[model samples]
Target: MSTYKLRQGRTMKSPLVNLAVRRLAIALVTLLIVAFAIFFATQMLPGDVAEILLGQAATPEAVAGLRQAMHLDQPAFLRFIYWLGNLFTGDLGTSYVNNMPIAELIGGRLMNSLKLAGVTALISVPIALTLGITAAIMRGTFYDRLVSILTISVISVPEFMVATMAVIVFAVYLGWLPALSMANEVTSITGLLKAFAMPVITLSFVISAQMIRMTRAAVIETLDTPYIEMALLKGASRSRMVIRHALPNALGPIVNAVALSLSYLLGGVIIVETIFNYPGIAKLMLDAVATRDLPLIQACAMIFCLAYLLLITIADLVAIVSNPRLR
Candidate 1:
């Protein structure tokens, strides 16, 4: 009997390891594809980097010399191979406009974006889960309907519009927070939080709306399960029943929903960041595009894609661990 249990443990462990290895392999392959796509897209972008750098009135000979100097004369395939080799060796190449290394350009901006997402998640997740669970517990009541209506209403508004409205109300009308996040650099904790206030709220409201709906659905389904019904019949207090049974059962799906929202935050904050002039990966990508900075653009795009893949992979692992059935 002990041997059988040991064998069962080994079998279960093997699959989990295999799952993790498979996910890692997929992530690597997807990153390669993203690299290729970003490179090609940048190559195809209109306007010549050399000309843009040298100006329109520059002689054709000067332009040709600059192009050759930048190795822009090389075929697209060769350039991609060279770039890919450098990427694997930890060199992200240099910008065409300023000649600054891509790594240095993106380092701080990426951290700023991460900080923004973190603050937004901290504010959003608990409230969203509470509202969702409350709605589920009061599933057929007026409170449930009210929560449903509120979340749906928030979801209906586009992020940029929501951001605009928040700036108008909180910055212009209320004079509480800064309208622009450009100078909201994080020198100190208080300054950081104050600078992040409007952007965090704007992002949280939009992100939390989807989470609220998903959490409500997940918890409601869990509540209807046999275990929950049995707990109720055993006269388990309402709070205890939900806290111990329903919430645990519902946690897997809630985590997945939050992960999905986090992935969105990582890559989908372009408009919000742009509107507020916030320094972040999305904003850096925008600047790269505007300047036709091929190397910088590719680096930022690859980073965003990798972040998204990582988040989903983490969500899958968490779900498997939280739900024994997945094992």
Candidate 2:
């Protein structure tokens, strides 16, 4: 009997392991497709790297020499092969303008973006969840209506517009926080909070709105189930019924929503970062594009794509674990 039980355990575990491997393989294929798309898209952009580097007055001979030196004269297919090889070896290539290593340029910028995303998520998720759960609990009440109206309103506004208004209200008019976040300003924890204040708020408000709506919907659906109704009749208080019965069942969708929101927060901070002059990956990519730095652009875009893919895979795994039918 013990041997049979051990066999059953292994049987169940093996499928999960196999599923994870399959998902990883799919993610790798998706990344390869995305890398190819990025490479070609940048290659198609209407400017010459050689001309950008040498200025408009450069002679054709000089431009030809520069393109040759930069390996831009190679056929697109051959260049892609070379780039892919370097990518596997962690060589993201050098910048066209400054000639700096791509990895060195993005290293600090990537960390800055991660820090911003982390702080925004830390501040946003709990509050959004709480508000959503509360709105669910108080459905049809004035409070619930208020929360719904507010979240909907925020959702209707664009991030850049919200960011502009936040700056006007908080930094320009009130002068309570700095208008622009500077690296040196974030020396201490308090300083970090203050520096991150505007950008974080700008990002969190937009992100949390979606979370609130999704959470409310999921919780409300769970509350309507027969199990919750029976629990209520069995002397379960509202809080007790929600905590013990409804929440557990509602968790699958909530986890999926959180994961989706987190992924958005990671990649969707571009407008917010641009508006506030935050020195994050988004800003780095924007500057790279302005200068037609193809290698750096490719690296930045590839990083974002990979991050988004990983987040989605994690969400899928979490959803499957929360509701085993997905397996």
What's the TM-score of every candidate structure?
0.92, 0.92
**lDDT by residue (tens digit), candidate 2, 1-327:** 999999988987777777777877898899999999999999999989899889999999999999999999999999999999999999999988778999999999999998999899999999999999999999999999999999999999989899999999999899888878785457798788777899999989998999999999999998998889999889999889998888877887898778787777865699988888899999999998999999999999999998889888887666556654443
Please list all clashing residue pairs in model 2, or write none if there are none: none
Q: What is the C-alpha RMSD of each candidate to the true structure, in Å?
A: 2.0, 2.1
What residue pairs clash in candidate 1, if any at all? none
Residue 306 local lDDT, model 1:
80
Model 1 CA deviation exceeding 4 Å by range: 183-190
Q: Which stretches of candidate 2 lie over 4 Å from their true place?
A: 188-190, 233-236, 324-327
State in Å the error of residue 110, model 1.
1.8
Q: In candidate 1, what are the lDDT values of residues 1-327, reduced to their tens digit?
A: 999999999998887777778877887898888888989988889999989989999999999999999899999999999999998999998987778888888888888898888889889999988898899999989999999999999989989899999999999999888888853456887777668887888899898989889999989899989989999999999999999998877778988888888887765488889988898889989998999888888998888888888888888777767775656
lDDT of 2: 0.89
Candidate 1: 10-residue stretch with minimal lDDT: 182-191
For candidate 2, the clash count comes to 0
